[model samples]
Target: MEPFKVHILGCGSAVPTNHHRPSSQVVEVRGKFFMVDCGEGTQLNLRNCRVSFSKLQAVFISHMHGDHCFGLLGMISTFGLTGRTTPLHVYAPADYATLFERQMDYFCKRRDFEVVFHPVDTTRHMVIFEDRSLRVESIPLEHRLPCCGYLFREQPSLPHIRRDMIDFYHIPICYINNIKNGAGWETPEGEKVPHERLVTPAAPPRSYAYCSDTRYIPTLHELLKDVSTLYHESTYTSHEADKAALYYHSTGEQAAQVAKAANVGKLLLGHYSARYHEENQLLKEAKSIFPNVYLTDEGMVFDV
Candidate 1:
């Protein structure tokens, strides 16, 4: 099925630790790449993971927190230094545009390419972007500051070519392309070849949801329903649920509850608090609620 994939570049929270970096992730779908957040050292993480920045079509910032966006200025400057002329689209809260522009001015380096910003509504849920093969939606979340989660859903592709029927009918290469594109073909002799007879349905489209730096919010369940993969912040243990609420972060068990409630196929828990010397406890606690829970570390890639 060639399922789309997501890579966790960095997965720490406000404070970086020797074991974890700040928030950064890359979601690749339909042969394109979209980066979520750009915490400190994100570019290094990308290079370490062997993901080329040239492939990134967009960046979605969940919020303006330092852990979520401190690396953005550096990435933008690096892009300019590399002579990147390709326009970069960034979806973020309205205040981020001003913040970035101010930082750029302070650096005195004008970008070589256009930087378009799409301001997302942190209080409402909506499908904010769509291309031929995918749709990106913004799901509001509860955080200390305004934030919005991102949901990526790939659109179903055209049916696959039926090799047996194509061989049997001696279909021309041009006609085969048409069949794979969901179009029926008619021979010069006026004989119609139905697409169903020449092709099989493509694999079901998959979805990946990203929720970062947010407190446990049950309203998000419906928005993330049935997602193939979910990446949620687990900033602390269940024992620290009080601290999680006080700090507007999530405990491992709370993240698991969201995944179970949403019926997400798999869960990748990241954004760990620096206090944790080991992550095994977080995984154990989350897995108790959602069996498919996986602890995400820097450079971990998963097929969605």
Candidate 2:
């Protein structure tokens, strides 16, 4: 429960507008930050939002699109200049490995920290990253280029220890961890104290899904089933359905359908086209289909 949240850095499409930037967001799970899509000015956004640069563990790029990854080199260079020593992990399509290496060699020479690249398939659903408290999985998406989304799932925490039981039984502090791990305690009088009596069940884990720059792909529903919150691209309104299909992008209506199919707790609409001065039309269209849709704006934060 330690801030399972998303901070929207940018939410515009390919073209940058005075109002919105490209695609970028920071997902914080249990106090650790994972950046998704480092669009232009993402580092500046991070600084403006007061996110600690040293706490950013990794960056996940949805595709090779400039709108999604153009800021990566700049961010890396900035990190180098700031004298960061921790290794920075970047996950992107396998095809970007060569390009990334070339850019790093030319711009990031003799850096203090290492840039670790993790090549993603972009065509399969797999657990790409895991820690003690959370896991990140790649969710294949339909796009003009090879692209994928990311699913962040929080690992279930240990059950709450029963203070009354511990106090009554005089259980040693050292044995608390064992009890939390489902071990029963044996009393000195040869009595068995079951773990069930020492701890309560843990709360269910929560999950968030980020589906950016993808068309309406039905297959994605299965991967996103029952997610706590979903951030899906809504680059156009229902009126531009034809254009959306032609460009392999999603309309607001399509994004809502995906959220409805997946039965998510809430749907966040983002990646808006610059053409619209206001997102009311897109929000209206999506809400007509799925009532729980929310619009994304720069600097907006959502707790999941």
Candidate 3:
């Protein structure tokens, strides 16, 4: 079966440090790829991660900040240079449409592919994109400007077949699929087997939420319930929460508080400030509140 994965290409604040790049990530559902927050040099980061540009179905921008959207033109131009024909969809704030389109038209007018812009209202908490197996929703967040997070929810999967039950009942191969699809089996003597008995229940669906640059919003816990994994910006330590608030960012302790309140399975902290020599302080602060939290790194792949 295809796997769901999140590839972290960049995880730094506005200033790109030697240890980390700007905010960028590639989320892979099954085999389809979606880029989130394409900051400066995102195209190079994509190459560094060995992510094929051809597989990217769309790009999702969290806000209009330079650190969140500067690399979009280069990524689109590279797609054109590679001779791609399929349309590339970009979901971002409505105000970014005019400038983004103009830049693309000037730099990539000769390309064969089409760049489709989907304007997103940063204040809404509605589904922005959906396919057969996945749905992406915008998360309302508190920020200096219009900014929002994203939630990736996977659809429920089919239950597994019970081979032992089928063998015990002497069910033929033809009826095995029916059992998996919630159908019961009957022997030649007309003895019936219940659908619930033939197969175990499927696992619950998994969800992942990405919170970019934002201050702590107390009401976010209600919206983030049932999320399996949460990636929130932890731009400062607990002591500098005052500074974090002033800059519209979150401290490591604040991120952990959100994770604990939301009851998520795991929390991944990213978007660290360059002031910290290492992530030990950040990780310690978050782990003190939420034990299941982990610090994100460049080129890291997380399974959801």
Candidate 3, which ten residues in sequence have the lowest lDDT sum?
173-182
Mark the 10 consecutive residues where model 2 has the least summed lDDT. 213-222
TM-score of each prediction: 0.92, 0.97, 0.94
By TM-score rank, best first, the candidates go 2, 3, 1
lDDT of 1 at 273: 88
Give the top-scoring candidate (TM-score).
2
Model 3 Cα lDDT, one tens digit per residue, 97-137? 89987888788889888788999999899999999889999
Candidate 2 Cα RMSD (Å): 1.2
Q: For candidate 1, lDDT tens digit of each residue in 66-165?
A: 9889888788788888878898898999777787777778872687787787888888889999999799999888888999899999998888888887
C-alpha lDDT of all candidate models, in order: 0.87, 0.93, 0.90
What digit string (tens of lDDT, one per residue) describes model 2 on residues 169-222? 999999899899989988889999888989999878999999988888876798
Q: After superposition, how far is residue 3 of candidate 1 from its true place, in Å?
A: 5.5
Residue 129 accuracy (lDDT) in model 2: 97
Error of 3 at 238 (Å): 1.6
Stretches of candidate 1 off by over 4 Å are 169-173, 181-194
lDDT of 1: 0.87
